[model samples]
Target: MVFRFAKTLDPITLFHAPSLQTSTNALNILKAASAAATAGTVTSNRGEFQLEITTAPPTTDQLRNIIDYVTANPAGAGSNKTDYAVGEVIKGAKDAEDAVKRFKEGGEGTFIRPITVDWTNGKAVLGDNESEILKMVHQLEAN
Candidate 1:
């Protein structure tokens, strides 16, 4: 099975495996980075985030796992209105073209570029690095 892993802008180590454990591990990393970013520890110098994967195009289930994790985490929204909205947008775009671009570029080959998120200007942008999964939930709640 082709496994895809997505990570933030920080230099975090990851475990590669087709198990929930791996997914959970990655989620934890995201949570920490998100928290650090919120606390001003991880600034724009990180330049968004990147999601690294072994698949040419990550599967929906893989993406959903990461999205679900973020949605259930505090770093995502934390009850902030603007942040929540941005999270919603990120969620909605999970299956978007941009999301597809964020997936690792390889598989039948090797070597891939990292994805970046645009957190500046309060604009929550999802990419290979980070995604705004909570944004979708917040949008649904607003409607």
Candidate 2:
């Protein structure tokens, strides 16, 4: 949704959100908010908008910060960014075994994974030594 600044009842600001676990850097939105809030009262700020995506996973810290922003900065009377977070991380675990244990116990969403790993790149690439090796590796790691 494209937001018109002048039409809005109050002024506004925006911030970039977490890019799943793939990235942990601030995007253009965050950069802009940083400039706006560089030296001022946060509550007095006109508004705050969170840039989020449905497909990409959201980090815990990102969700927390977004919730705080939504609570502190009212967005013209609306439930803001409630659907922005759709990510569940396997935290406090380093090893894969521990991570799986934590995820199985406390992970947010149910990851409906395929029964087997498909080695073919569509119909273009068939099975090969690489595929066989991958199959072996996939089998070595039990479900």
Candidate 3:
């Protein structure tokens, strides 16, 4: 008999802007969650994960991915304008195209901070709601 354990590659990324209080809070929360997961105090179907924290705005490709990920998962929009989910991630973007345009014009300054992305599970949470953030963190990975 052969025994094998598949490696877990799930990465939870936090797009943080140090100046913003909300982003700071989200960072702290994610840190705790990461610690809990490492300590086995937190359990998820996804099990262990690597938390990537970046103060820099995501790259253009990353921005598009974040927008798409959040759009597909509307819970990420929170109570914001659901009609234009892009605006939830990018401050003034009306849609995908507008998001790119505004991002080009304003650069990193236009991004709405404190977005946490669980890329492997296609889930993203925008803003500092501890509950929402934690929910996204510990949710099971869809098969």
Candidate 4:
């Protein structure tokens, strides 16, 4: 008899800055959503997920991956490509290279706060948009 094990998913991560009010609001939302998901109250096809909140900036590699994820075109016919830019992720960044430069010079303060990332689904939200964040959390799995 063969037993199939369920895949372990990456936690939904929130890159937050406590000093920012928007980040605080996002944190509250994430907490509530996390509880709901754990309690099976979230009507989502993706099921329950773990929440990870961090105050520190993402590493260079992580930042790159997030930019890629956010800008990637959704798979399917006639799907419009996402128009997101690196500046959306890193405040005042001119481009990906500039983002890295600014991050290196300014450290954590350079990163935009209240960003929510669903690593398992390769989706991210740059601000405390409650509806958008929730949508990502409850996104249906592609067939």
Question: What residue runs in model 1 are displaced by over 4 Å at the alpha carbon?
Answer: 1-19, 47-143
Candidates 2 and 4: which is better by lDDT?
4
lDDT of the structure predicted as candidate 4: 0.78
Taking the tens digit of each residue's C-alpha lDDT, what string does model 4 give over 1-143?
A: 99999977558999998888989988888888778877888788777788899988898898887877666465746432234777877778887888888988888878888788887767888778787777777774333
Worst 10 residues of 3 by lDDT: 75-84
Candidate 2, TM-score vs. the true structure? Answer: 0.21
- Candidate number with the higher lDDT (2 or 3): 3
| Index of the highest-TM-score prediction | 4
Please give the lDDT score for candidate 3: 0.80
Worst 10 residues of 2 by lDDT: 118-127
lDDT of candidate 2 over 64-143, digit per residue (tens): 33233322234554432222111222345443345445546665442211111112111110112233222222222212
Error of 3 at 9 (Å): 3.1
Give the alpha-carbon lDDT of every model: 0.34, 0.29, 0.80, 0.78
Q: Between 3 and 4, whose lDDT is larger?
A: 3
Sort order, lDDT high to low: 3, 4, 1, 2
* Pairs with backbone N, CA or C atoms under 3 Å apart (clashes), candidate 2: 16-30
lDDT of 3 by residue, 27-97 (tens): 99989988888788877765668899998889988888788777744565443211227888888788898
Q: Which ten residues in a row have the lowest lDDT in candidate 1?
A: 108-117
RMSD for each model, in Å, please? Answer: 15.0, 20.3, 4.7, 3.4
The backbone clash count of each candidate, in order, is 14, 1, 0, 0
Off by over 4 Å in 4: 1-7, 72-83, 140-143
Clashing pairs for model 4 are none
